[model samples]
Target: MGNWESRLYSVPPQKLGEFVQNSLRPFEDCQNKIDKTVNTICAVLQEAEQFPLVISVAKGGSYGRKTVLRGNSDGTLVVFASDFEQFQDQTKSPSEILHKIRDVLRVWQLTTELAAQVEVQMVSGTLTIQLSTKRQSITFKVLPAFNALGLSDKPSTWTYLELKRALDQTHSNPGEFSVCFTELQQKFFKNHPRKLKDLILLVKYWYEQCQEKLKYAPLPPVYALELLTVYAWEQGCRTEDFDIVEGIRTVLGLILQQEQLCVYWVINYNFENVTIRNILLSQLRSSRPVILDPADPTNNVSKDKMCWQLLKEEARIWLSSSGLNESPGLSWNVLPAPLYTTPGHLLDKFIKDFLQPNKIFLEQIERAVKIIRTFLQHNCFQHSTTKIQKIVQGGSTAKGTALKNGSDADLVVFPDWLNSYTSQKNERSRVIREIHKQLQACQQKLDLEVKFEISKWKAPRVLSFSLKSKVLNESIDFDVLPAFNVLGHKNSHTAPSPSVYSELIDLYSSSDALGGEFSTCFTELQRNFVISRPTKLKDLIRLVKHWYRQCEKKLKQKGNLPPKYALELLTIYAWEQGSGTTNFNTAEGFRTVLELITKYQQLCIFWTVNYNLEDETMRNFLLTQIQKTRPVILDPAEPTGDVGGGDRWCWHLLAKEATEWMSSLCFKDGTGEPVQAWKVPTVQTPGSCGAGMYPITQEMFSFRICRTLE
Candidate 1:
């Protein structure tokens, strides 16, 4: 077996427990010595003559929490002074306080009886005093704090606000104010069960080994690891007695996901207070690996990306070495980040802030579209018969669901000569080449800078180029695809005649191409399908599209996944089936879509609003399409296209990601219960429809058809 397997087999559970008891635990003698040294330091600080401003001394750090390991001599002493009130304004630096405290310690060491054995010095801006004797030496770090939390275990909102204001103004280290709440920091861990403490010790021991192995390589703070261990136990196994190895395994699993790790506690401060909530939200939204100090909102212990990378690398090795992969379900089911219940208003704000394009961006897009439309209407192609009939804008820009900074427009160019599907398919390539040449040639005449992606294919279908001008912050990309105008100038409210779909089915069946081959022919209909939805429904579509883009970025290296249009259609289906109202809970709608994605194998959704089961040929073709495969999402505008049904795309990867997101905080509410997904079925059946189903036209079939073949 491997090294991890061997190491695990060699150490039985009973033996591991005994090892912790003997090797990791501090002996009574060492404990007594450390306590005596602590008492001596407190006594020296209590001297009123040497330090009149000092009020009281409180123990902090691991020593204060009673979780210190054996032979660890380091400790923190928080000196709260009544006269340091002026420093609370944050106008004065913390070094001034440290210097004042250091001067008093210096005077005492020189005048005290143990002057020969005691050494006082300054280290890293903190006052350090080493008490050395014949047996051993103990080091104490003195930190002067404002004592923000005066006498209560739970401080008031006003008290925290004052502290937050001071912290925000200070130029010093963010954690400098953390000392002010040292008691809360100590109490955060002091109440844990004995078994949980042992888990912390085990994790800390593992961390120490990694630090020794890496030597000079930076790692996240040991305190952050301690908090991570506590968080794991609290979320995974809250009981006092739990399996030690399982706890270790869970922590290691979390460490491996350090890139997305965002953990915090609401015990000390929470989102109820407006000021604190804003601060917490901003902190949570920052770059990953955000481990907020439980006692101090301003401190993020795991902020260094390079350090987290180093720690994650080491964690991968140790986790593999533990030989726990053989045991499934050994680790706890914990998400790296906490669940955030987004209210409707907050989700709306999020869409406006992050997803929706601003006025200026829309204006720029319009200007670019105008210029392109002008060119398509006036410019001539090389072929005498290849005159442009019309150009229609499609895609997210037309549907009003485009995201910020993602600027692109799809301009479907319909040539006059390509009247039939066969002719259009044959002549579209030559038309695209002609357009590409003319676009490059007319840059000077149009007074616009254009850049083209030099295509390697000789018969490219779409001519892709970007337009640059002074009015645009970024170049707007445009895709000019020449297609057959099968619909001509049909009314937006009217569906195409059955003959249109009948012709498409016949042409698609005769060719060796996949479905959606002639989808561009019905661009106007496709745009109208989504553009006419409720405003709130469109917002939901935007949210779903944003999520799909994120998944695309991550899964791009694996292979081609499902198209974003499939997800958009699924969102529309979910909203139609779940709640047809103009306003609904966005999170619920989002959850419903993700839940459907996870069950992609059962998705057989289609909308009969634009096409129906009236015509015999069209009905037979759709029945064949839906029955061909699972995940059959027939394009509303084109019956031949099954956007969700394709063998080339990797649907399983998207399903896997959706499953993980189901457990994320995004799906959870303020009460910590999972936000309920709509009661939408995975497989859309004809019998499942009620009044909420998309309204069918009077000319359509009276009976609904089941997804299964009769």
Candidate 2:
């Protein structure tokens, strides 16, 4: 892994070296502008009587380290103050000092001279000043810190002395005060081999380019990448004469591996001190891809594991390129480019040709639903009052997103015998067993000439079975789930009352704490939410599911993938957030969903049509669920159920697929316009437009023709 020549890649070492040099040559003008701005600011602050006495300002970050890119780059100006004790005493906290410094700078910013020198922008508490020249402008974070330089003269009075004490007792970081050690941090990377610095710049360039394309979530900081490059160089054949191409590949390969990367230097900090040692050890063990700050042991820079995974996903794609494969001569694919261009009618045809289900499959699914419903009705428990209340259809079939080749339906039977959700949970296994028995009886009773494919004996939450028709030469699968009729008893015209959710909250709080535990009880609401969507939106949902299925096939995903239901809900959320209309760009909607998949970490989608925030208990629970973590698409029907779950890897795989698919021709048309979204009337009521939420009898299904099939 350390040898670049041993590893297969499309570009020759010479070619890569040239590309690296051409892309990452540092600009001296940008660095000079930053230096001049720091000098001018320091000079002005020293002259201002109202401001704190200025000691000296120094450059920091990439500029200070001499690893900045040629064009627009970020640098930091560390403003050290003489009145450290007074500033610390007067201010409420260390963070307040930054605000105070920014406030003073804001006053100075209004001055014609200062305004002409730089444009001020306040971020979090730090002041960012952008200095403009004829060619370009460079931004710098103006961090004000207490002078800790030459601490040997006043060892007892040094802020670092007190800061170590404060940090030991209370884990509060001294904020930007850490910038006092900026010179040390910059010095750490300053004297590294010129090749190492260039290698770091190349990695930075790749990261920046990938970031533009993969806007999935917040990426790991640039500092982390620099540190990673440094670690790679130090660990792997440490030499100034090493291949730059090898160095770049090693860095990217490390990112792809995503192993626990814990690297730190003992040059500055000592592990001999127990406090520092413990802190360092804990940070080192914090999370995978852990890169502890060499300057500050307490700060583990690689804590954003998801962001690193996104980077890793990109690396994997680059690593898999045929050009990169271990072959003879150099032959790589062209540079990574955007796949889809314009919003046209590609998505419309995708829906019509691939996504939309055929009439025969829909007919088979309808027949299966009726057979299951009739079986549950006939097998009424003699001991119970209401045997089978109603059989509600769900999943892609009910949501109108069922694919033609491989699709499924969920038929949840609400039994009146089960008093509540709790009862259903406790007795679901028994109910499923009875239904399984009755399914065998129904098969004998109907003798419907449909082939019974499998005979699995076990029945847990859902009774599974398969039916195949000789005429159609196809099979349709069903998972018959038995649930309590909580919502069935309510009035159909009006929404369920607050009491319904309040009772649900109590049930959830008292029941098992596992997510999606009570989804069976809310199958009706879930079906209704999907079935109530507009026709075009349903088509969009189908397209997304098709993409998901493609990912599953392409990735050969064996274990539990992120649930298909989550993707359905996500499509609806995208449509609602984008153009919530029947007539919108299909390609745009598809692109939006794919883009959202990349940003699965920030996904917090839920519907309140059936349930609102008016109910306090339900509202609180709902809020808690939404705030849990990334890919949090709360089950609109069952608040406890998070459909976008299983593992982060599930979403990771999908996000990677979305990234690759975004580069395909499927999204474009002849004129190069991206595929357009479907246009249909906004639908009302559940089970309308052949979404089939309500179980249709054989007669109704035969007569109620759907235009989708036509």
Candidate 3:
């Protein structure tokens, strides 16, 4: 065993709980002293004659939330002033109010009855007054803020609107008005279960240890860690008397994944009003580690990525220490990104804002595609017997579902020498090698740098490379796959005859080929299948793709999941079966697709857009393919391709993630009720099954298959 494992096993599990109980408990005397100190400060600030503009003084921060550590005497006091309500510019007005408060503190320290006990100083160029007591030497930070929430516990929509307006005007410091919502911030934690507070204290203590060890490096604010602890407890173990060590381990594990953290709560504000909804979406879509302050939507407590990085380094060390036992699975199953209870309109706006590539990016992609086509036609196969017949652009870029900042192009190179599926399969490696060599030879002529991803397979099917040039902001990735020209320079809108697929099925059945062996040959059909959809349907596809990518990033460690193309086809199928109209609700469509994924065991989806189902050869092949696996999404363009079949895919992981997402805010409506999914069937029922080329048994399949006359 490792050092951490040995050290961790030395301590009994019950002793860890006792350690938390004894070492982390707050002292009664210290609590009494801090309370007296806070009362003294509030009483002095409320003196009517000395401070006229000061409306009320209240304590804030960890002390106000009752989650402060034992030895930590740090506290914050927010002084609400009447003048702040009328102040037009926060950049100037808050400074003026703070100056006045500092001036009063300077005078009161000398003239007041508690003169010798207190020392006050200004914290230069900001709205903070640092006060220290001479006896215990406890420090307090005082600030003046506008009373945005007033006496109401639940802030109104106008309150959020006013806060949003103030935030928008003051981009220099978006969190300038955070102090105004001190009460809500305090209440956010004050009302939680007492054991949750203990978890926060333990997490705070751990954070302090990190600070002491890494004093030179910056760390995320203690408030961010505290919020993270609360989230861990709520999501992982919400009982009153849960395990303390488990809570610490979960938080430490979460800190390691800080790059993906995008947490927020809907207690203070939600996506209801249009202005607040847009603001919330914009905030959520910001850079990583976005732990939005529950009280103030404008304040992202964990905005600095570098600080999180430093803390994450410390977390890794501690996670391997004796306290955590180095167990990774002890952490919560919470997703780092918060799923918002988005409406259909808001979902549309989110797609437009976050998913769709800009016009310039699209144009650049098109230019890159043209350049690649030119390279393939003129330069790639110059010295070989196999010449380039035609190149078709595929993947998301060709289908118009490409995401922003994610640029990829798929070029299906149909060689003239390979006329059948067998030749394309057997001779693809040589063709790939020839194209790779030619690409290196003509690299300087294209004025672009190329980097190839070395394949582990001796005869890899696809040639993957990245191109870097001054013409693009970022590198564009290319996948060059060699396939036979089976459909042969036909119009993409037109479907192929049954003879095309008949020959393909016969070729595939006779050889030791995988299901999607010749899928690259039908790239044009695959692109056209999606590219011909309505604009809104494409937008929905983008949303589904975005969700699938998130799941892929998270579940990659488990095993290989389904390909992005299968989910794309599933989305198209969902739209076709659930809502065939050009305009449909995006949230409902997204929900329907996720719901289908959760029921992947019953999934048997396909389309007849490019192949004729009436043909005996194609129909029999599809029926036999669908009967082989539970998740049977056949490639619409190629009859032999069951894109979701085989033992290679781990659908259970995706289904587990999908089940969790169904309960998240993403599937919830504005009223906090679950958004109903569209009435889409898990299995595609055939109108009528043709006569017995393949045997169909009731025990083998759940759905019925009729044997029609040939």
Candidate 4:
């Protein structure tokens, strides 16, 4: 058996303790210096006639826990506001209180150790300040919190529950009450064993050191690692004199092995109570590495899978060293190394590297596109024989907005046989059967290095087939929808004839039965509309699509939701309404789409870029469709199709997610300025549509009057 202790002791026992303490000296000094600065700021607040709202200030977070790391150690200055209780009473938002505190803090004009005046940057959530002396600079995150329970004993069930309820009910912001229980948080990790604290410092040190190595991947919060260390100690024999190195190794090992480690403490709250237990259980069962904040049950510190994967990979690297490697008869059970990840930075490159398709995937998709196009030209029907009129590539891949690992292509097959709207409506079923049979025959004949699975649909508008390539070891879904091309081959911006939609309107029994049934016919125009957009707009579309996928996977959402195509159109509409340039801000574009999504019910978007309501038949159809209900995004190609009709729950979920992601690093640049959304489009309601001015644009019946959110 390998000497695990010897491996851990290889650094030398005395040196290990000295090395860790020595490494911690700078952080200790930084924390102390920050404490002094915080004290000075509080003193200034107390004396200043301008800062009457400031009540008290205290050190919290890493400094409070005594687990601050070297380099950039984060300490929080909890500013208790005098108007906090009043704000709660008046039902003011957390941001409102924070901004009020921030405005007062800005007026200090106080001198720091190094800088002439303190440098303050006001972000949406918190205030960040740089406090420096001659030799060292400390960064402290100033949090404006309320002392809901001042100097009280551990909070009772009702106290915690009421705070949580307030957080949930008030101002729709998640993280609204993050600082509400700062005192409780400080007390949770207040009196841990010295060795365990040392081990925490060591794990945090490892985490900080690896920041440069895994810059692209997100890391779980340091507090999570600290909690893991505590869990290891509490569960595996609580010993004061336990080996510090062993503890470090065990914590890393647990992190690597933790599929789902739900760690919590029942000291303050009763877990036996059904309400509290269910809440705790829900937190535990949430997206993996679920370590609930011991004090506040709402905050799951390890919800991000990318962060967990990155930490796990780093842990594996550390454990692979001498002595720490798997001993005889023991399994470290580590997964293989991750694929070589390209560095992610500069919104466009990040989207391309992490989110957009790579060269290999693109090549595979290109090959698949070729295969489908060839099959359409050779095997698809013309008259009664097998031939196609036009094969258009649609969806994300065609629009050049596909993500790296997630994407699907649409092959719009315009058959020569299906002449008019009635013919297509009556014969599409048999045509779908024939196309399905022919696709199978082609797959059998080609016998390519791919596993093809064909799906059967009730209406079967599109021939759905999933292709798994043997070489790429990835799959690309292809939906071959047979259509009738009323508008012949044309560029992306060219307008299709009004007669095409007129033909569509002729077939519908009632105004409610719009052209969604003839969606396949307008596939070409749909593809072209997005294909002709600016490069920046395409990238923005990719970003929105990426966020949508995240919303689906993170929320585990199911059932019929708003289609990706609708969101894509919404992004374009936002861009056109705002910048409409090739070099516009990507993050702003992303935020605009999110804002639009939150305002989905009020959305009334339509574009006459492809087909305007010129003829009375098409005009009446669109006018009725536009004023029908909420979220009216009329398909530009097929005006009868209202693509925005979906369940309201999905839109609500997206709005909730957008509210959360507004403060994420994804939507911010290096300077921490939030990407501001453009003024929403002016939506035209039913009462105002008949203002005598018929056409909004040069094109007939192309008016867009959207009501911008106040």
Candidate 5:
């Protein structure tokens, strides 16, 4: 009755243990590096173990690591990956991967231990066996789907070439195959161990027979993919993964000089399709762990639409394969998690692990430094030694955040230095504009490939910048804030509104941080982000291309929008959305943010403070929308002017300028009219003023003072 996780582990992969600790690129969280390291470790483990069960067992212990095993227990193991979706709806759980592998191993371990007594009758994708002394033999292999647990079996025929001169090689007993297998298993553990090569050879005859029987006719491209997917097993387990070179050859004729249709052929294609069914029955008979197609969505509204597509496509391709046209099939049923197991979500736990920096995070500090080296080269457009560190903030994956279907990417931009700029609020606007420009160009022209944009966000009068780039097919967003040294406290870094941090994300991305250093395709930070976690996990990583968009104003106003903040939001939404997270649960993680934001509410409020656009001059014009109160995602719940009003902190800071405006203290000499917040005239406060405002100053965009009163 129990499900996959409750079952025992599969065989462990041989850990290559050869990974170099990767550096954390400044853009990446330290914890993410740990996840990557864990995954790589698991990948290596999977790599070393050519056996079917080894992959399942090892990946379960690692993060974002999964092995989808397909093959008969008595035959060879074929390993593939489960989907890596953030909303969980599209993929399998790390824990589930581990549990299934463990269960597979447990069954094999126990079965082999009992081998002396139980006989191994057949070794197809399924296994059959009978008690050594009994007339009946049972065969079993793991099934892809099953509602009930325990055992199931089927009868099959085996005909060997009748020998003329030889003594009887076939056992005389009706169920001798099972008995001999059992005897072999018992002997295997007792001695130092039957060498693994010999164990593999034991199934050689069966492998050939299975392939010969199933080989059929296939179409073109499908045949190529088959060669990529299946032909390697014919060689050795060491060559399991896609050989890009070979894939290129198979798909594009092995010549990189030109992009064209492939000339490759599926010379020795075999059908592992029906064999899968056969193995399923065998696993059932052996009481092996159940296998499930991960793309099927659970009760979670997180649609498997994406995953289902992948499954169907794979199935379709396999069916069209040269040797398996008759076996055309599709998802019959996707069983719910097995019975007698924990109902709690393991991904919830995985996200929970991200709430804070653990010891693994320390490893990333080192990684971050390295990432800086890589990213800095491209980010040097601003030309300062300016460095950035990763800071955690609140936010969410696109899913479950709002009416929007999925979570959007938010990147936190933290600078190592540039305390001076945080002091002056007016300078931030110009700085951010230039930073945005530099980054936009950096991504296109430099090794960093980072494109960025910046725009005005008032209230607390914070600036917003969005960074985007591509890896594979998806666009990645790096939402950032620009601040000076003023806000550099633990948990919150304050800066003058025109801070240097986000500015550098732009500059370095262009000029390699102006050191004009090494050119790079991806900053070390970007690489680690890619390496540490899979962007394909979900669309949370879906966008980051151009910061400029049709809806920039609308996007930032909806949330605080800091990268770190958005990340927290993702975890919260993941909890709510069910890995399948999203659609309606918008405020899922606000409670936690409520506690954390109190300390930085003033700053957060600052982000909300916007200059009034009421334009009392034009009675009830622009004010119409502002006055129409509705529960909107970005709307301040109450007037930001008061503490009880949501976003009050932002109004509080802006109110200082309002008071100055009301007192007629904001008039500047150049405007010849009353101003709100700008350099006060010398006659009013001369000593406090800097050099008179010029038409084209660096702070023109940030402060926006001196204008001809048109």
Candidate 6:
């Protein structure tokens, strides 16, 4: 994305002004938007029961974009994607409680700013300032949506200033702004006035600065936008919302600078078990003559036998939040009792699989946990098992979401009120402590130096964060969420069985049926739902409408619930609505959930890649894809061989034609030529196996990075 950024210096002056006006017009509502945000925040604060939740409220931008109305006591919205299992809460209103989760993780809608005032109000709940409640008829006519769209068809980039001014003038008069904005932008603005205005202004200021900067030297795609958002945070509030805002902010900043920018963001990764995955990647590198058990006719996932309903619940919850009420147990829903640990295991597994190549993953997990544990143990937190979990608890996930050699892990921890304030400053520091310790441990344990982070959220009684490990010779991360334990609840001081933890490790290795009836049910249910979700929103809406209608019809019967109750109940029904008890209240919640869903789809793709009974060539394609370290689509004309010497890429880069020498330098099909096979034994089968192959050797065998994205 950085290299792909544009480097345009400027645009015509009049066009610039036009664009800027378009940017500013809709932002007249800044005061109102800010007021709602603050109000929701303050409201949650007043009745808040948790601390880390408060932290989420404070760190607004980290999640995503919404009208960003408010925060909640639980901070469920920010971490919904990590929640793969259902939570106990059923009555809570997710929409009212937290903004529904969204899809795009990086900020997208804004390039400028939203219209909102910080908000002034009550002593307790009573209003003090007598604010004016008035309206003005402002309209401006400039261009038609069609004309703007037509203009956009040209290869041109406008100035941020032009867009903002255009927006301002438009709001000063909507009649005119409509004429300036492109049909696509207009369509968006008509539906999202706040977001559109925000983008316009962001572009105006940041893009202008980017243009000005280009006069000096080249800049990263997100440089200008990053500067602007960071500048805004420095100016006033550094709300959690800054994270999401920064996302789109950075991209637009780059786009504004240049017009034909082509950057690719990593949408997803593939893997599930942290330990096993790292080991596999390491083996692929160190093991010269890598041998995969081709004799075994087995695929990773058992889709055909899976339970849809249970899978749905697991996918909904675990994928949303990494940490939950309890470490997942076998749910009768999707997996057999022995297959998966719990509904939440889905997300945990996804993270591990996605980052299979990383080396120091486990060390980070333990380190992250220890950081929180040590902090609490050293400070106001008591070591009592029963009380500790309740007062201090949250879950976390980590992988190779790094930028440089030895990057830190995205370790996000959210502690409740009692735990967060228990030691105050040291509370967030505790998570950092864990990250530092774990990195050190990873070095010692895995013989690999590591770097990681522990970011804490600042909200009402909340302390949430993300930690990223450095990428040195390998990629690794530990995104762990440490939750505050339930104080008065029975869970306080409860410790999971040591065997259970080991069992989880074992489960990853073997294909065992953990649960029977329950697992089948869960699997079947999950499958049905996935098979049902159509591509069109209209279709989904229709389904929801029909569901409500059904409930309404039931109301007319003798002992049925009322129509109003039915309406509300339908929405309340978590699993039926697509997301079960997983809390999604903020932009973060929505984004995380959406991401999890996408990952779930990827899992399907992975499964398809590995298993295709109807298609005879699928297994070969998948195996070759694994060996070649690249995606392999089915094509009968081209067949894949065993993965081994294929790992030796770019030999031709250093020497000449490596094709002849490459096979000699390395092994193929677990066998190599004279020079390569001499070290490893040559297969000398009976005359039944006509032998024309030479012995292979491991001598002079080594690995090197032949290519890199940068």
RMSD of each: 19.6, 21.7, 17.1, 18.2, 26.6, 28.7
Please, what is the whole-model Cα lDDT of each candidate in the order they appear?
0.73, 0.64, 0.72, 0.64, 0.25, 0.26
In angstroms, how far off is 454's CA in candidate 5? Answer: 19
All candidates: TM-score: 0.54, 0.46, 0.55, 0.53, 0.22, 0.22
Q: What TM-score would candidate 3 get against the native? A: 0.55
TM-score of 4: 0.53
Q: So what's the TM-score on candidate 5? A: 0.22
Put down candidate 5 lDDT per residue, 547-628, tens digits, no spaces. Answer: 1111232244543333322222222223222333243221222222222232232211111111121223211221222222
Expressed as tens digits, the lDDT of each residue in 1-710 for candidate 2 is 22231232455556666666665664456456656666767676666666556676767887788777766778898867766642243233446546666666667767635322577777666578777655445678877666665443222223334556655455555332456667777878876898888888878877776776666678998898998888777755467877775566667777865654555655666445556554554554345666766665556667667778788887776556554434322221111111121123545764674356567656756775676566567654544565777777877777676765447777787777787867878888888877676566656666444566545866476778776554432455778777777777675334577787787778667766567776776777777777777888888787777677657755664555788888887778777756777787777788778888876766656555666555557656755665556666677777777787635446777777776556444556556555544332221111231222234343433233222112
Better of 1 and 4 by TM-score: 1
List where candidate 4 sits over 4 angstroms from the true fold.
1-349, 380-384, 442-451, 456-459, 469-473, 488-493, 509-514, 554-559, 646-650, 682-710
Steric overlap count per candidate: 2, 11, 0, 9, 114, 198
Q: C-alpha displacement of 488 in model 6, angstroms?
A: 29
lDDT tens per residue, model 3, 1-710: 44433443345544666655666656666566557756766877788476776788878877788876655446678887776773134456456656766777667667656422455666665544333333333456777777776777688889878776765566547666787788888888877888788778777766777677677788888989988888877765668888776677778878988877888887888665668776776776667788889988878898689888878876777666654653332444444554443444467877875567667646655765677689888777666565788988888888888765445768899888889988988888888888777776665566423323423334467787764333222345678888899989788778787888888888778877877788888899889888888999998988888887767666788899998888988998888888888988888998899899988888887666777446667756766777766788888888777877745699889988887666555665665456788998877666312111123233323232323111
Tens digits of per-residue lDDT for model 1 on 1-710? 44433553346544655656775666766566557766766776777475676778888876776666655445688888776773354345568767766776677666655522556788777678665544445567877767677767787788778776676566566666777778888888878998787777777776777776678988888889989999888876788888887787789888988876788887888777778876776677677888999988878988677787877876676565534443432466455764342333356666775567666657756765787688876765644656677889998888887765445668899888889988877888888888777776775566433322333434477777654333322345667888888888777568788888888888788877568988888899889888888888888888887777767756899989988899989998898788888979887998899999988887887777667766788767866777766788888888788899746578999998887666455665555466788988776655443222344443334343542623
Instruction: Indicate which candidate wins on lDDT.
Output: 1
Preferred candidate (lDDT higher): 3 or 5? 3
Residue 409, candidate 3: Cα error in Å is 2.6
Q: Deviation in angstroms for 689 in model 1?
A: 7.6
Ranking by lDDT: 1, 3, 4, 2, 6, 5
